[model samples]
Target chain A: MVITPQRNIVSRTWGTSVGKKSVIAVTGIVFLLYVIAHMIGNLKVFFGIETFDAYSQHLREIGEAIFGYEGVLWGIRAVLVGSVVLHMWAAFSLWYQAKKARPIGYQHRQRWEGSYAARTMRWGGVIIALFVIWHILDLTTGTVNPLGGDESAYLKLVASFDRWYVALFYILAVVALGLHIRHGLWSAIQTFGANSALKQNALKTFAFVVAAVITIGFAIVPLSVMTGLVR
Target chain B: MKLTLRIWRQASPEAKGKMQKYTLDDVEPDMSFLEMLDVLNEKLVLDDKDPVSFDHDCREGICGSCGMVINGNAHGPQKFTTTCQLHMRHFNDGDTIDIEPWRAKAFPVVKDLVVDRSAFDEIIKSGGYISVNTGSAPEAHAIPVDKVSADDAFDAATCIGCGACVAACPNGSSMLFTAAKVTHLGLLPQGQPERATRAINMLATQDELDFGGCTNVGACHEVCPKGIPLASIAQLNHDVLGATLTGARSD
Candidate 1:
């Protein structure tokens, strides 16, 4: 069969940096929302192992009445995977575009402009990507988890945190994620054309608060587990 | 005053460029940066050597024709000053200044200190103008623009198309230059008809020309000779988003 040349809207738009930026902004917000929800869900450990285990089981049973078991969970997973792929694609393309813009390097340069978060975006993204892979292996696949898949969700969490290195790594990853979210949120809003001189301070504050809350919220889980507070 | 210059010398656009050293004595402190270069060029001419070629139209700052990365800073260390307007008094005796052209792929070097900035012109040609039927000059009072908006428009309009913003940008972004034009037009009544289309078209051209994305570095504002504020870029973003969402057409 002959393949037809079809011009998709995405292909047409993604040809430009502005279009790529729009993709990045939309996908970034998706990841931000997911992280916030994940943090809250993880916090169920504070209510006891039954509550946390029930919460984990509830995620798998979502939409079971209509679509059968694990259907809604798969749906959520699909969306998240799509978002991550799109986000990474846009980010890499943008980075390439930036590199192409300046073919030569400066003999002497100074970082007189840009924010700390803005400067660290590339490295922070790398850290987060590495953390994501390690996290899935340890928790979801039970490959590196000390308690293994046979144990309860609460027990696995405690077991992983009891290893000091694992908890420290988790804390570091969350901190990097926090920095990424802090800059990403403000940049996304600006990209979407939601910023102005009058609203600059308020928007910045909102970005900082959201990032801090999510990071601290996630960090508290591993810390509590390691301290035996949750165990 | 005495000074040492490490100037980039490239024979042509395709030629390999390198830093060439030169020492100048009795350089008056009152001489402008461009004037200092002129003295050096004069010396080269007297010595029967090929003088350094740099672009300059009006020696004044309004033309935006003259620019060089002086000592790693666009237009030198003086804030909001053009290369032609920078005075040598800012430097002391025995200072070594490194001079190089803008190092963006979008701006290919023409010679020693000049780069092709026709990309900026193409961006303007895309959609930086409004349609008008020529008849007679309209009265100034005919259009009643609010003072705040009129001032803001004037401020944005002051951008001289100087590539300093791009040169100073870490990513080599032309957002400030494009945004100045977009925001200037978007704020006016006459520009309202093409506001949406102008934003979309100009930004599209800018991207096509291979300018980097703006990460809100604020470098463009810092190095702008006209002191164009970063707010203009925000307005440009606002306009582009509105145009894209509303599916505005250029026709």
Candidate 2:
């Protein structure tokens, strides 16, 4: 209440391109945490359907001793939803600003820098967003899931991926997620944790490794189901 | 060496421009890229034709007065080399080269190869000048700076306000140029008092000028003549984040 003047300044700061990027960077960390935990949880299916089902049920029951049923899961969902909204808002604003900055085209333009991952970040983000909606519907809500309502997360994953096309689509989206993380994670570091130039190489390598590990971690589940390994 | 040059020719700031082809017969490998242009200009002037105009002052690279896109890369094809310092030796005989101006909304083409880069100056003005004890130089060792910070400060200070970074960026963002100035001063003790405001105001001015937002593409650093690293831009982001969360304001 006393900081209304400061609030105006903070809001105005977010209105700037630099401040908008800050929002993207912070929200990016949120997604990173969520996906990593989700990937690790997905690994429980390897121990068989019963173990995977227990893990899925356990996620909702986390911190229930203090906060009551599904409290922690709801809190996580709220933060994740908030993060996705802010991330897209900032990303779109920056995208528009970037487009408007160069109305005139160079007759002799050439690709001089950036990784393949960096260049495809915008498109990859879009792919991942679409996949997230499909993913939530299939597994979380079980609405369009082949196993349909009340199925556990493991059975939904198995039923969906049993079809070759679903497995293929899931793999495609996971690859896109990997590419997005390969560049986005390092970029987020540059925004929030930038300290010195000496650590750049190490940081970049770390980003790439994390991205690759997470992609493989998520992809294996669908691959196992498609190949009848998890059936 | 002989070469074919496709150069953009614009008469004025508001005029439409087109690429005109020219040939240079006696271009020596030892000659600087700008000197080769000089030879071409000499023949054009003698022929009563309008010569190709480009910006250059110090034939040496440090002045930052000269810049042009040669075959798409800002400051020519070489890494860490300014256009004036780029020599003809790198090219093959009878090679074709394309020359153009720094293209960006903030840095509009002033003529053939010169873009008005006053937007950079506006960003600098927002940073404001650092106040120092000016009556006499303070004791030599009075303000001790760590080796790493001092080295980085010097690295950031080396940005010559050249628009090469802006020209090279895919989005035409001036983040590198603005970051250079911000880090150059912010790293020093003299720059402490205004640090918060400097970060906020400079970025605000940058947005006001309609320059693009940096996407961390690393194109600017790739073509930077000074080799101003991407770390500077990261530092700029860091400062702005700190400023925003702490409720810092220019006023």
| Candidate 1 collision pairs | none
Report per-candidate DockQ. 0.37, 0.49
The 10-residue segment of model 1 chain B with minimum total lDDT is B242-251
Looking at candidate 1, what is the lDDT of residue A115?
A: 75
How good is model 2 by TM-score? 0.94
lDDT of 1 at A133: 95
Evaluating just chain A, the predictions reach TM-scores of 0.94, 0.92
The digit string of per-residue lDDT tens for model 1 on A47-132 reads 99899999999998988999799999889889989988988898888888788999987776753557787788877898899999
Model 1 ranges with Cα > 4 A deviation: A1-12, A226-230
lDDT of 1 by residue, B1-251 (tens): 98999999999999999999999997998999999999999999999999999888888899999999998888899998899999999999999999999888889999989999999998998878889999998998999999888998999999999899999888889999999999888899999998987887888788778888887767888888998877788788888766666667654
Instruction: State which candidate has the highest TM-score.
Output: 2
Q: How many collisions per candidate?
A: 0, 0
TM-score of each: 0.92, 0.94
